[model samples]
Target: MTGPVVVGVDGSSACMAAAWWAAREAVDRHAPLHLVHSWTSQPLDVPISQDAHSERLYGREVLRRTEAELLHRHGDLAVTTDLVAAPAAQALLARGGDAELLVLGSRGHGSVAGFLLGSTALRVVGLTRCPAVVVRADDPTVGAGRDRLVAADRDEVVVGVPEPGPAAEALLEFAFATADAHGDLLRAVTVVPGSPGPRAEEERRAWLAAELAPWREKYPKVTVAERVAVGPAAQLLLTSCGRSRLLIVGRRPHPSHLVWKLGPVAHAAVRHAACPVAVVPHG
Candidate 1:
């Protein structure tokens, strides 16, 4: 069994939505749910007596009440809570490495430029060893049967292919697992990193064909379809999101160090995808 599903909750409306989202995922995966909250020990710039330690204590109480309320409301779910001693962002990043999925609520806490580029979401997006799902307070709907590449039949699972790396296994595993569960086809998609050179591209396609053979045969319920295109990963993914019920992606490495930064394509898709996206780590 996997570790608990993690969600950052602060009692806000957006946080509530994030909790609901995480809860649904936890139920689907048959995993425990972990609701986390954090606060700093520093005092406010104003002449405030509330130090960071006091604030954390208050935060802990709030978390306790919140968890109790959640458990009561979702009696059927197995819910747990954690009150940690770090800022929300840092604590989330630290815990993200162990959880199956990390989710956050967007309260417009970052800059306008950052929001346009999805910056605040990018912070943990790159660093997390698991996929992080960010839900906007204003977002009214969540999508399902959403695929980046979906088959025509109803019983097909859609898998997303971000830049292949440590997390490639997540997409492959999710696709097959879903197929195995529902007796559906498994669709895989990869955004061509720019238009490929003809010969080089052909070689990659051959490689992909070879890679798929074992999977298709092993999971006979998993029929396969592939999509390759160029432009941006996020945009392509968003397009794919329109077609499939679920999208699978790799966990972002770290935001600051990578050239492409936080896997913008994955970021855009997760924030805006029509279907629920599972950002799984390769492990």
Candidate 2:
């Protein structure tokens, strides 16, 4: 949390929404907000005319306008802007290396469809060392009229708790910290593969409680609820998002020889969750 919160801006409604979200998060963390826009020259192989100078100007304008709007909404917030001459994904990664968090917006196809993450956002989320949050552009909660920057009293921060290990520990650390920051309830959920008997169910619940004990001690003021369900992990987590202000899931680094990939649960949550989703890489 040493650096400012960085958000990618492309002059789209989606990026604007993400900028707003990032502003609130920055305020909560007592950090600055940085808006970044990247532009690149067209490949020589393409026949279409492309003006690198014009594109650079447009990128600067986008950053300036976005910075103005965010400062308007959050007058006291420390805001900065950058125009990078590189591809979107590359620029974001380089800027986000020391950031507290990287925020991006995902477009929704329609009411029935979930998020449609663009290539830049997907790649950044997969590879970023810091936590990446994907905010839906069409989220009703985000807008100019919203007066409250903090989460509601009843809102909860839901985190998908994987098997007990380093990954789960990292995920819960973020979830508890966020919930404590906003004074929201923390809900930790785990979904097993198959239906279990009464004894097994009891055992699972006990295990979940044991897993959360240390976190509870660490954040004694933060209230926590543990839930254990039997079903697909992604579906259950997505269902929980309706009541959650933020949904968190964990992603493990891919093998050295292969490209980084988002695990099944993290991928599904970012794509379909009703609330803003944070993907944290651990282990």
lDDT per residue as tens, model 1, 188-264: 76655655777756665665566667767777766788766666666766676544555666654443433325455
- lDDT of candidate 1 vs native? 0.60
The TM-score values for the models, in the order shown, are 0.68, 0.89
Give the lDDT of residue 194 in candidate 2: 60
Model 2, 161: alpha-carbon shift in Å? 0.1
Per-candidate clashes, comma-separated: 13, 0
| Residue 39 Cα positional deviation in candidate 2, in Å, after optimal superposition | 2.1
Residue 131 CA error for candidate 2 (Å)? 0.5
Report how far off residue 181 is in candidate 1 (Å): 6.1
RMSD values, in order shown: 6.4, 3.9
lDDT of 2 by residue, 80-107 (tens): 8888777777777787789989988766
Whole-model lDDT values for every prediction: 0.60, 0.77
lDDT of 2 at 178: 89
